[model samples]
Target: MNNISVIMIAHNKKEIIKSQIEQLSSIHNISMDSITIVDNHSSDNLCDFLVSQSRLNYIICDDKIENYSLILNTCISEFVNTQNDILILDPDSFLLPETLKKLSCALNPDNGIYAVCPQNILDISNDIHSFSAALNYVNNNDVSKINLFKIIKPEINTILLSHKLLSEHTLFDSEIISDELCLTDFCINNILNDQFTYMADNVYQYYIGNHNSYYSPTNRNCDLAYIRQKWHMNYINTIPSSNLISMINEPIDKELNVLEIGCDCGATLLAIQALYPNSTLYGIEINPISAEIASHIASVKTANIEESVDLWNDIKFDYILFGDVLEHLRNPSKVIHNCRHILKKKGKIISSIPNLMHFTVLHELINGSFHYTDTGLLDKTHIHFFTYNEIIRMYEENDFNVINTIASNVTPMLSKKDSEFIDALTKLSSHKNDMLFKAFQYITLAEIKDT
Candidate 1:
């Protein structure tokens, strides 16, 4: 086993830091001297607590240095030459006994694995609060079972990074500002160099802090913009659309042909392939850069959906998916009409369209202000808007029979204040419903009418 040095950052989290150090001290093959705590000038007498502990290494940062990426880079630079590996741990996260062993097994430096992270229970849900609570919860459950490992960009919570990789290259892009984005940029650079990052499914970690607040709104947005500028494409387009995925009713093992219009970076298509492994996937993305990325996973064509009808003349698909694509079309009805020719006789169409009747849009209209944002219900590129009924009507009018309508609500269950407003609106209007205010998008399934 190679020597692994641990680095943790502290910012006013005295109790969490105490728990972190206790957990770190219990891990096998790790000594008290190997852990370095960089205190970001905590006011909770955390430094005083650290001073009492003998054999522990600690550094007190000046109050002026607030950037997390910069602090982490400084620590990595100092330890890169001496340590065989470095483990960056979050202050509020607790690792299980087997986490390091699992992560070490996955991080085969001979196979060019640059970084590996344990599966975080907090990533699955937000119900668990602290280390003790999480430990109690997992104790009652089985821990031997494991899921398949995933290849993903590294997040800064509990990743074990290779010292060799860090020494040969820059540790983190301090310009990214946030630890997550900084590490993600480093992981991407490693990937481009034929190295990889893996998520160890069998290893488990529990996170309790509000990690979302690690980056300020301004800095996060700027970091995202910097990443977008560097990647030469919109980063958000790479996220798979769950609304559309939930509407897919096909058998998981069935062999079929799937086509996604406005597929962006083919994330949705790749997700479909994951579910329906025998399915042949295709994508129609307008952005050439996104299409190029999509091409690696699916048969992608870089062309506008309306003008590319003849592009698939030689092919027919079992399922045609429109994942928030219709509203962006200049003539959505014409495009839907044209899709009939390329669809199989009994083919179904699944679409996830933003609901214009959502409360947020209604609230903006009530205030006499209708503005377009970069993305959302009133995205600047959207040429048409539709309510749930209108979306169903569009397909029915296009000679298709509506099969199902699944509402995807971003808002939580209505609160008393929300219910009261909805009740008042229901008394004044016939078009009002509780779902209308709750559902941000509607996923509709349609099949061509038998002639």
Candidate 2:
């Protein structure tokens, strides 16, 4: 077995550190001698506590290096040897019994995976018995049974670094000022290098405290803006729409021509290309930054999709996808009506539209707070809102017949005080499954109405 060095950053949280250390010590594969605590000049006598623990190693950082990158680089240079695999751990993370073992097992150099992270339970309580129960559940159940997420970016809290990866690249980006963003930069670098990060879905890490407390609001905003400027696009724009991808039900063998509206980074188009290798993919993205990235993957053009029907008048598409785009358009009905000119006779328009009549929206309105947010049901960019009936009517009125509808519902937790309002609303609604109160979005497939 290769030497594993456990790296932990401490900042005035002594009790949580103690609990984390105790949990690490319980792991049979890891020894207490391998752990190293880098104290960030804590005034709570955390360094003194580390000094008393003879089995574990520690470093007390002085006022000389205050920046997170410098401190991390200094510790890596001094403590972690070239052959050692490093585990960067958050102090508030409570590891399951087999977390280290699972992480180490998945860190094989043969695979292109450079880093391994355990699944985090952010809402989990700090109970050892609860962790034990979760461990048991993980052990007995198949991996598919657990709700696993396919992540494009690295998650915070607990991550294991491979020695092969560390040798090739620096662990953290010195240019990034924020500690949180530096890791994100590192992840982006890994992705660029064609190396990947794997999440150990079977392994669990119990996280305590607010995840956003590490960086101040000002720093976070500045760093995010910097990252966006550096990367040419925001992280959210780069992510593929999984729900929209699932709504595409086409024959695998048939080579279909597909066009996506607002194909931000061409991620979904690229995914479609993968699904149908022989198919042709086209995209229209308004943002030039994201359009440039997506242009490499598909025949992407930058245009205001709301008024760009002239661009695709000569070409006919088998499928025109609007993934949460109609709501953001000033004239969605006009766009839908214009689709007939560009769509093949048998072609269909598949759109994922947000439900305006969701319980959360109703609840907010009942409390007199129908406020707009960055992204959600009441997004600042959304120009139109539609319920299920309105969505069907919109398509039918636009010379299209609704072929199928799939509801994506999420059961919300309502306050006890608002129960009476919801009860009265449910009693009045005609939908049988409380779909009006629960359906978050509707993925509708519509075809041209036969004259």
Which one is best on TM-score? 1
Q: Candidate 1: where are CA atoms >4 Å away?
A: 49-59, 81-83, 109-113, 122-142, 145-156, 163-170, 190-196, 233-239, 265-281, 292-301, 309-315, 341-345, 413-418, 448-451
Writing each residue's lDDT as its tens digit, candidate 1 over 1-451 gives 3488888888787788787777776765577777878878678888888888887777776564367788787776664346568888888777877777667666767867768887777665577766666676667777676543324353436788877777678667777777677766676566556565666665678766665754568888888899889877656353467778787777878888899998876667866776777889888888886676667668889998888654765788888899888998888988888888888897888998899977778778888989999889999989999988888888988999888888886677777876776677666768756677668898888998898
lDDT of 2 by residue, 23-48 (tens): 77765355787788878768788888
CA lDDT, every model vs. true structure: 0.76, 0.75
TM agreement with the true structure for every prediction: 0.83, 0.70
Model 2 global lDDT (CA atoms, 0 to 1): 0.75
Clashing pairs in 2: none
